[model samples]
Target: MLELLSYDFMQRSLLAAALVGALCSVIGVFVVLRGLAFVGAGTAHAAFAGVALAYLIGFPPLPLAILFGLATVWVTGVMEEQGRMKLDVSIGILYTATMALAILFIGLMKTYNAEVYGYLFGSVLSVTSEELHIILVLSVLVLGLIVLFSKELYFIAFDQEMAEASGVPARRMYYLLLTLIALTMVVSLKTVGAILVFAMVLIPASTAYQLTHSLRHMTAYAAVIGTTSAVGGVLLSYAWDVPTGPAIVLLATAVFFGSVLFSPKRLRRIVA
Candidate 1:
């Protein structure tokens, strides 16, 4: 295992996994808290449409996908606020429409590209140094934004009405949170791909929720769980010659179920 670190690609893969894991887990806490898991899923699929568009148009996918994801969020927010549609309803409609667009784009291609498949399912081992740099920069930006707005975000996540009453600009903070989620999804797309990115966003946070009520502790625990799953999955995928994205998601899922089995909250409820 230690010998693998000598290889540059392996080292980069591990580092990328750690960055993505920590970033996704942290953002996921808010997603879980705000009951926005569906939104996360929808945004990821919308980004998938962007990826397909990139492939079709011969442009870089990540930036385009980021734009697409952000646009999806903006549309959802607008529909909910101005068009008088529920968020879930807007998300569901947009999610399906974007997925249909992705399929349509795929069909339009005259010849299938294997690289596009990697975007669908992830190709972390193939990540280049430049791509890693992009991930690092974006990860730092996401973390910094989270730190700067931590209090406001926490207030909004737990009690939007109260936060708004307190003049916290709850609506704007919510949009910022969505932007962070979009950026995180774009950075993570190469590691876990569009299909499984939401699992990376969701599972570790859900696992931590089972173990703690404190937001601080939950965020920390989720990061640890996510990093562990990412590293472990990368190692397992290398050893077993399996797909890395699914491997990471499966490990995260295992941790979530394990947490459920031994959760103190579950035990307390049972005893009560």
Candidate 2:
């Protein structure tokens, strides 16, 4: 482990992974409570589509990815809030369309772009210094906002109607949550990739949920679980020379299952 930290790229990769892991799990607390799992997944694919378009048109990938991801969640939030359509149905359509767009953009490129594929499948060990800086900046921004509005976000997540009844501007807060979800997806795209990023958000929170009924404890546990999985996966990947993305995700998955097997909540249910 000490030897791995001796290298610059590995250091950047570990930092990026830890940031992504912590950010995703923190925001994931709300996502799990609000039942935004599908929407979160859709935003990731939309962000990936934007990355593809950016690579094809020679635009900066970050801006376009943010645009597409935000558009997806905003549109989904509007449709769901306005009662125009079911949230899942709207996001489902956008999800399919965005994935198709991603494939189309990739196909249109005359020559293959390996960097583009990095965003698709993730290669955390390849994280550049610039990319690490971007991740750090965005992670701080998103986490800061979540901390600022944690109460309203949590209130609405538990019961939007009740929150609105209490004058919390539930609609706006819902949009804010969706926006945060979109940004979180974009922030995590490179480290975990579009395909598996949602799992990074979902799994740790879910695992934590099984262990505690308290939101604060759940979030804290998730952060620890996520960070551990990410750093552990990086070490294992370095040792085994396997892909880092899947390694992190699979390690998180294993932790999730372990949590499930031994969860106090589950054991209480069994004893009862």
Instruction: Using TM-score, give the best candidate's number.
Output: 2
- Estimate the TM-score of every prediction: 0.97, 0.99
Report the number of the highest-lDDT candidate: 2
Model 2 lDDT tens row, 1-272: 68879999999999999999999999989999999999999999999999999999999999999999999999898898789899889999999999999999999999989999899888889999999999999999999999999999999989999999999988888988999999999989999899989899999999999999998899899999988898888889999999999999999999999999999999999999
Clashing pairs in 1: none
- lDDT on C-alpha atoms for all candidate structures: 0.91, 0.93
After superposing candidate 2, which stretches have Cα over 4 Å from the reference?
A: none
State the TM-score for model 2.
0.99
Clashes of 2: 0
List model 1 lDDT by residue over 39-128, tens digit each: 888888888889998999899988789988999988887787686888899899999999899889888988988877777898899989
Residue 205, candidate 1: C-alpha displacement in angstroms: 0.5
Worst 10 residues of 2 by lDDT: 226-235
Query: Number of clashes in every candidate structure?
Result: 0, 0
